[model samples]
Target: MTENKDKQPAAEEKAKERNWISASLWADKEDIRKGAERYGEVKWYKSARFWPSMLVLILTWIGAAVTGSYSEAVGVSVILCPLCYLNVKGYRWSLLLFAALYTFDRVSVLYMRAESGQASGSGLWWLLIWWLVIVGATLTAFRIENYRHKHNLAGRGHYVKDTLIALAFPVVLIASFMAYNIFMYKSSLTDEQRKALAFSYGFISRNTDGVINYCLRSGVELQKFPEQFRQTYADEITKVNDWLEKDEIFKSGMEASLQENKEMLYEVFENGRKDLIRLTIAEETGEKPENLVWKTEYDRMISPVEYCKLMDESFEIMNSTGFFDSFVETVKTLQ
Candidate 1:
């Protein structure tokens, strides 16, 4: 009888431990309902997770507004506002969403830098630290939610006020940035500079993607029509370039547009060069290439020099097509 009494206490102790573990590790509807009854709906707003997330959210918006990344800022705001709301309201899945977003954004940034041949250097370390902080913050948020559930201090409130407040950050920041752009930046520009900027935008909208698409689609037959295609394309480009070269405004606008998008241009040309190499090797090995290679009906692989020349001419010809007379008329209207 005494032994049975001792065992009964031991079993009770084990049960308590199990209950504690479940409460800390899991949150179901019942526990949340009980928490709401115990602590009321506003419990989430008072959470340690809530204020810090808010601070970080506001700081992020501020950073974006200060930098020239207005569009990116607006995009992040749209994505994060709802996540922030759900997170503060004790939804555990919000933490997962946060981690996933941070990972994708950072990885894409790194990939773009590498693609552009920008050295990571110390920036990589900063990115590593940033990733670590994101992971740590997410884990901490999960722990906070768990703690609240364990203590019956968490509840999913209507959070209408919280939602409005969260959404206001992005809305206000975007509006402010737009006002600054229109009143400050645009107003500061001279008439000539404004015209140049407009011309630059028009030129890129007309030429850049069309040139890239043409390069990716068209191929030069260096053996059969080598001199013929090259000569004709060069003549067309020379005519357009020569006509535009006389105008100072056109030169400035074209230079600025090209420089601004040099990375994209470089990527297109580099990929084309790689495709040519891949096609050449595939022919030699009698194996299929992994990617589509641009080739003419002749389907003959050429030397690297010939490939480079072909790409150069293609870029110039595609950029020059229909742009010469169209932009000449555009320039006249601007004047």
Candidate 2:
């Protein structure tokens, strides 16, 4: 009985020792083991995780290359490599790394959008998706580590070392590629090109406003003209209407005009004045009749006199031949 009692104490001591691992040290050890396993799996490219991840990476590269977006391909490749490594090894730190990298990548996209003066709505959507994936992967890693701890898995130290090595390699590759791009493919736009682009945007804005105003006034005037006038002017009015529908400049102009007027002219005249003036002058009469002439004489015939004056002012503002020449010169300077 004494011998059995002594043996029981020794067995209890061994059990206590086994359960008494320092939490911090054990966590570090588990991390290292997970990393090493991930590294080995990635390096061999033989794990189940490898095939799908590699397939995605290859497909992304091919798609980006086809679209002539090499930068996108490189970025995707960088992201995919680490993702694959993490999935195979199931490291907690891999999830953290993914989250950090994803955040950094999204910030870069935001910066690019700001530089171009564009909305980042789509970018935000993409970032949200990435965040979800990172979070899901992290939770998966935590579950996996818990399983490993329960199982008392061996060679955790080797696994951790492997994961770190795997992570280091791809990181270096991505950094080198970025450095090369920064050093080699710098784009420096000339002053003239910048000015020309500014002028082009301004010209586009002004013309759009003019087009909208002309369409609205013409539609109103046409509606006021006789039915014969509407038929006679059908083709010309149709051409103008088509231009209003298809021309981006005209559409922009109409939008601008509607905004300026605080009136919904765009909604009213969306279909344009197809039912308006069809007036035709009788060639035999040779009389300077008061029928609504669709010719340049209609400009002189414009009433309220103020509208005519405004039309004239618009024409003068839009008719800067020197400005056009300067715009062309600016484009040349860019080249």
- Compare the candidates by lDDT and give the number of the best one: 1
Off by over 4 Å in 2: 1-63, 75-83, 103-134, 159-168, 171-327, 333-335
Q: Candidate 1, residues 294-332: lDDT per residue as tens digits?
A: 456423555445564565555446446753455444444
The global C-alpha lDDT for each of the candidates, from Candidate 1 onward, is: 0.55, 0.47
**How many pairs of residues collide in model 2?**
21
Off by more than 4 A, model 1 = 1-67, 81-89, 119-121, 168-264, 267-335
Give the TM-score (vs. native) of candidate 2.
Answer: 0.34
Q: Candidate 2, residues 1-335: lDDT per residue as tens digits?
A: 99999999997675446321221123345444553344344343533224445555687788866754455566677666867676556555654555566567667767644433343588678766655544443444454455555666523545767667677867887788667655654353344534444454343433343333444443322222223323533453344334333333333444444345433433332212211212224333454444534554543433323342343344334334353354344434433
Instruction: Please give each candidate's TM-score.
Output: 0.44, 0.34
How well does candidate 1 match the true structure in TM-score terms?
0.44
